[model samples]
Target chain A: MILNDLSELAARIPDGAKIAIPPSRSGVAIAATHALIARNARGLHIVAIPTSGMQADMLIGAGAVQVMESAGVTLDEQGQAGRFVAAVKAGAIRLMDSTCPALISGLQAAEKGVPFLPMRGLIGSDLLKNRPDYKVVDNPMADGPDPIVLLPAIQPDIALFHAPLADRRGNVWIGKARELMTMAHAAHTTLVTVEEITEGDLMADPLRAPATIPAMYITAIARARGGAMPLALEGVYEADSAALAAYANAARTAEGFAAWLADAPGIAAA
Target chain B: MEYLPEELLICTITRLLEGTGHIAVGVSSPIPGSAALLTRALSNGKTGVTVLNSANLQTLNDGAGELFDRAAQGRIGAFFLSGGQIDGQANINLVGVGQYPQQDVRWSGSFGSAMLYYLVPRVILFREEHTRRTMVDQVDFISAPGTSPPEVYRPGGPYALVTGLGLFHFDKLRARFRLTSIHPGHSLEEILDNTGFGFDYEGEIPITPTPEPDRLSLLRGPIAAEIADPYPKFAAAIFKS
Candidate 1:
């Protein structure tokens, strides 16, 4: 369905929903995250494809995320994510630390409708010890004598992201960032916010057809320009330096974060 | 020949990348990223290097998925990893300090170190700070293990570890780090005082060699420019001299 605004689309996500957020430098729905925070959406189990940065920190700081299953959450060059680290320090959320390949492999399993997928890593890592959910099983197919780690399929309640363009039919043109498509295929529902809604069918054009995600998997569509604010949208704009630094510093303390969010344009005004 | 500490470290790491086919330097790793580029330049572009998110260096069109897929397929020859704490067995801990559930000092979570460590043929563990604090006896958590059990299928593991004080080669058979070379201005006694873990050393250790004049010029010149985009601060700070 076509939603008039981001808030309405954000409101549709129920409390305690398992949501998959795409990684940064790709198509992360920052606008949706702000709306979710504005609507006081809570108890979200945030799944990062392999890892996340600003979006994860924002959700955790706003107390929207209850459980985080991610390979890592870092701000890249900006150093450690203070709010996420603080949350982990206070035991505010359940942290399921994972490897990058494991999360992708799990999502891949879900996309293929498989119960579990066997991977080559995590044999001697502490993740296996800490995460009881992952199991080490003998490779039945291998006549050789090596065991492999089996990751449970991660089927999220909703897959959410932002893209440069979407058609009236709700089909999104993701270009080279196909992980968004994988997440949409794996999750039960897919929610998308586009910077601009193009006129013609995205699938009709041969040049754009390959990268387009058909409307079949999309549950909702909303036009939210500058949606991926603070974070860059690939070719559109660069991640706002002043904003990221401001967020990082303000998020050091809960009070500071609240004060910053009080004046936050997207979150507060929305 | 006199060289800056950063130059020395980069040249030292560049020496380690002699025969590597494809090297991947992850995000926030400016030193290794520079070293990878330097190695590629010296090899006449025979070496394939992919620095993630780097404007000048990355070759992957499909984002992290492509990088991870290539690594899993064993196409990546070497990769770089660092830890909040590194132990005797070469295990790197990217997680926080203190207990498991509630950590006193939490760092950025393990992005792909655990998986890449197991897959990459030569995983170089690099940590700039050489101290008992950074190099612990045993890590609070093991984000990626150095050695897997015999029953586990593992073709890749730690090759060498580069630090500020010196370089240590990880012997998989012994599952221990050996004192290889002491960097200029650092002594065996200083390393002993600082290191929390024990390492095997035979006879008198030689000083870690500085880059040749030609190599040094290349590193400080064109190589410096290549790394500037990904690590502007590091490039400016080190390449200025």
Candidate 2:
């Protein structure tokens, strides 16, 4: 289904929904995130595909997140994620601290329709002790005593991200951001915001077909120009570092964060 | 020749990455990334570098999981890791200080450190801040352990640790860090005063080698332009002159 605007897309993501979002470097649906905040979506469980950045921080700051599961949340060179740090310190949200490959492997298990996937490492880390769901068992194939960690499958209610292009047919082009594809496969529904809608079929072109996500997996699409503002969309644009720096500075305090959010370009414009 | 602290750190890291076939740098690592690139250039493209999040520098095209998969297959030769707290045993805490879940302080949770530290052969631990607060006697939480039990299926572990002040080599068998060399303009006393953990050192500790004139030129020239695409702000600030 083609959504009229980002608000409609945000509406589909109900309160308390488990939503999977890509990292900052990948195509982040910042516009849609703004719409969710404007709608006052609450009690959201955010599954950062492996990690996250400003989008997660903004959501946490807005009190929209109840649980955050990821390897980490940082603002790249801009330093630590201010809101994320504040939230964790205040014990505002439940944090499911995991390694990058652990999250990815969990999602991959869901995509493959498996109960769990075995992985090496995490033998003596506190992360294993904290996560009760992750089990350590003897490797049956090994001749000697060999142990490995098993991560339970993670299936989110929705996978949301922005992309460079999507056809009227709802086929979205993700290019080399294949992790988005993994997220879509592991989620119950996939929502996307794109820069433009083309008339031609994306899969028809041999060159473009490899990177395109078929419409069958994508539940809805919203046309959002410069949707990934402040976060770059690979070939389309570069990240607005000045704006990110401003956000980092403003988000240091609760009142300052509120003021910044209220006057945010997308939220105020809406 | 006079050089910035970051430049010296980069040169030190480059020396550590001497003959590592492929060096993969993780997120938010400008110095190691630069050093990897410098190593590649110095090796005349013999050494491979894969900087995460860089379109031009990254060679992995499969997906985010590909990097880990490659490491598991023993394809990635060297990688970098840092922590909120590091101990004498080389155990790192990227989680936070105090306790787990509900801690007084928290950093961006543990990244790919747990797995990468185990999979990659030469894991170079790098942290800019070298203080008693950071270099702890024991990490509050072991985000990734320095060494695993002998029976565990582990092929790799910490090779060395580089800080703004000096360089230390991790003795995996002994599970201890030995002070290798202090950086120029810094002393053994300064290291001792700031360090919370103890380390082994010979009678006369040597100073870390300064970057040669040619290496400085490479860093300020082609390498700066290459790294600018991913870390423009860092490149601009460091290579401004």
Best DockQ among the predictions, by candidate number: 2
Estimate, for each residue in A102-185, the C-alpha lDDT of model 1 and write its tens digit. 898899999999999988888778787888989988888888877888999999999999898999888999876788888989
Candidate of highest lDDT: 2
lDDT for model 2 comes to 0.91
Task: Report clashes for each candidate as comma-separated counts.
Answer: 0, 0
lDDT of 2 by residue, A44-124 (tens): 999998999999999999999999999999987788888999999899999899999999999999999999999889999
The TM-score values for the models, in the order shown, are 0.97, 0.97
Q: Which 10 residues in a row give candidate 1 chain B its minimum summed lDDT? A: B55-64
The local distance difference test score of each candidate is: 0.87, 0.91
The residue pairs found clashing in candidate 2 are none
Per-residue lDDT value at B106 in model 2: 85
Looking only at chain B, model 2 earns a TM-score of 0.98
